[model samples]
Target: VLAQNLVIQSSSEIRKPGDSVKMSCKTSGFTFTDEYIHWIQQVPGKEIKWIGRINPWDGGTVYSSSMKERFTMTTDNSITTAHLQIDRLRGEDSATYYCARDTMSNQGYLPYKNIPKQ
Candidate 1:
């Protein structure tokens, strides 16, 4: 149900090496108002990998070990949106991005399921 909401939501895009990019991951299917929106990177002809995680409910950011000081996180409780911004984007930043709602409770929180190649 939550996935349906995200699929229909139109997200904005960001330009490389420019100002910060803001893409929101809104949720409203379970107890997600106080949850984590985990961001990931999907490279062409490759698999998706963890990028960073943002606790929209509390404005906390947990970046990958190698990704520290590369990204930032914010949230708008009124809009139920979690936004991620990467500074000074590089070639490595050029990839498809996804956000998953994760929280202590597993309700309405389905792990990111990728499409298998045929």
Candidate 2:
């Protein structure tokens, strides 16, 4: 279920192979720095995968094992936004992306909202 009183928004992107795409997720109605922001991806016909998450309070990030090198996560407290930048885009990178607050539960990082892709 979607979280109440929280609003997350992201835009769609288009890019060519070898290019880079930076997606942004903006949040409102909550304390941006107090929550962890996570990025996820869903391929056209596959399951959703966890990309990574950033600790807004300290700017620390933890990415999925395969995505460490080319993915970067950052946050801007001023605008209440989290950013996911993927370098060297490829055909396999074509998918919908999402950003959500990491509620930190036993289940793991779950994205309550989604972002679109390149």
Candidate 3:
């Protein structure tokens, strides 16, 4: 699927320890089910972690080894949106998060990139 003029929007959140954080990725300029949406986390001074991805076409998802235990992935194709929710916020979760569209080829990702942390 060609994703010309694709745009994704998500907001920052403020949460206390042990709270849950639900982040959304609203998209435009493409059919939501035409591609997969992946979430990633970049903790300050650390490498990026792949949270997971959802197949809007079938509502199937895959999470990273570390994140699968505590994170959830969902989508609402009707709204052209995908979501990532962290079950328990810890100090380690203090970092920027991002929603990306898998370019669906060997060319690699062409995602929106960064969003503020919770």
Q: Give the per-residue lDDT digits (tens) of candidate 3, residues 10-101.
A: 65577877888787778777678989888878777897777888999999998898899879999989988888888777777777777777
Q: In candidate 2, which residue ranges exceed 4 Å CA deviation?
A: 104-118
**Where does model 1 exceed 4 Å of error?**
1-19, 103-118
Model 2 Cα shift for residue 74 (angstroms) = 0.4
lDDT of 1 by residue, 30-84 (tens): 5556567777767678876677777766677778886677777677778776666
Quality of model 2 by C-alpha lDDT? 0.75
What TM-score should be assigned to candidate 1?
A: 0.69
Return the top candidate by lDDT: 2
lDDT of 2 by residue, 9-115 (tens): 55567787889877777777778898888888777789888888899999999999988888899998899988889898888888777777877332443343332
Q: Could you estimate the TM-score for every candidate?
A: 0.69, 0.82, 0.82
lDDT score at residue 42, model 2, on the 0-100 scale? 77
Model with the higher TM-score, candidate 1 or 3 = 3
Where is model 1 poorest over a 10-residue stretch in terms of lDDT?
109-118
How accurate locally, in lDDT, is each candidate?
0.61, 0.75, 0.74
- The 10-residue segment with the lowest total lDDT in model 3: 105-114
